[model samples]
Target: MQQSKFPKYIFDWFGGLVLLIGYIIGSVIVGFVGVAGKFIFRLDFMQKPWFLMLSNAIVFCLVIAAFDFLIVRPKTGKKLNFNFSPTNFYTYLLIFPMMLGMMFIGEFFTAQIPTTGPFFGDYYEFFENLMSGLTDDPVLMVITAVIMAPIFEEIIFRGIIQKGLMNKGVEPWKAILFSSLLFGLIHGNPWQFVGATLLGGVLGLVYYKTKSLLLPMLLHGFNNLCSTLLVTYTKNESFAQAFKIPEWEILIIGIVLFSLFCYLFMKKNKVHYSDI
Candidate 1:
């Protein structure tokens, strides 16, 4: 890659800022929509789980489209790849376990950190309420979590942000690391940050290797599906606890299986992307 005249941190910072602004704007728009729905249509849109999910999907899609049109397309002169290639289907499947294992490892480490007090506790309650709302409408939750979230997130984080950085002469590792960090920060909480960063790094690697947005989207969707199901069914139990096994055991098993799969995958496939 040719060296860019601009600093790499500019792209990193801008990517995160754009997402933050987009989310704030999206929330305000949704709030207005809810107000209008309540007064004009005699419906409490905020109380409707499906409408909330649809609103979130629309917001994310619009943000992604804006970034692509205003920034990515003009600069790169190429639309982001969204194709579903079967060339790495088996390898892609392995990414699920890899991500899950990473999440377990992250959670284990995060649990060791001392509590940050009432703020963190309140955040947990907020998350629980959010999950409860989703669980109230299982179909909507599936649509939003499994489908919409993955598509929008991958397009923005991997397709637009990460790829754009690389095009501007950012080193592949730096691009992946900063992009993953941005992904984690976007989740807006420490617990989520740790898990998201780990998963995002893996997703970034997959995207860099395959040059396909579809793979990460599918993997992300699968991860979300599993998480949503666990939250819905397990109620009070964490994923590790729900299995009726010790946390350490789960972590050990996850590590061993993930390592084996990664070894097999790396042995079979050579990265084709020169930039990486």
Candidate 2:
């Protein structure tokens, strides 16, 4: 970890700036490629809402990893660890169900938050329209939604940026909060932003506890996959009607249960935010 020559807060600011720029540059490049591919090939696959998202995620991971190895690790004198374990595998048992439940809960608040305009509505509408144009391939959806997203998103957010913040002497809460906030903000959705932030924070805490990027990666991917499944189901009138219930109530239950489980897990694991 490279010690900041500047004040502590300045480290976050500078780190945040670097991360933000890196994210934007990578996103723009990926976006350009996606749009150009769609235009040149007259292919709707490139335009599919999830295609670019998953593709961008993959690109972002690769960029972050390359940058970490070539720039960050060398500068900071830290080695990147990409290990996984059974403990990490078991962690998903808790994360996946709760995240899925949270998605249902989040839908109830959909109208309360800003889901319209430049970042929110337009972003989703863009993807929704693109998805509408593409052929629904379950295999493709699983590959893109379940596998690619978890691997890449985890690498960038949990592995690189979060690790950078922690190494810079940032407090755990602050590190988690800021990293999660950036994660949400970069998504450019006001409505989903809050939920993503909360989830990101939780995932950060998990990462901090387990010291494993794979845990958060699985949680993030599971959350996304659940959302994708829900959207798929809702698209079918019969499926939507059959499962229709007071989702808000379920969300409330999920929140409570999640809180309790998290508390227990943290306590049992004897995990707290300590210097990484």
Candidate number achieving the greatest TM-score relative to the actual structure: 1
Worst 10 residues of 2 by lDDT: 3-12
- Model 1 error, position 90 (Å): 3.7
- Tell how far residue 16 is off in model 1, in angstroms: 5.4
At residue 226, give the lDDT of candidate 1: 79
Q: lDDT tens digits, residues 73-179, model 2? A: 66656655544433634455665655655554555555356547777678767756655532266566666667886787676676667776776777888878887
TM-score of each: 0.84, 0.73
Tens-place lDDT per residue, model 1, 49-133, is 8788878886886676555554555665654344445454577666677777766676566565445467777787776676688
How far off is residue 272 in model 2, in Å? 9.4
Q: What is the overall TM-score of model 1 with all chains considered together?
A: 0.84
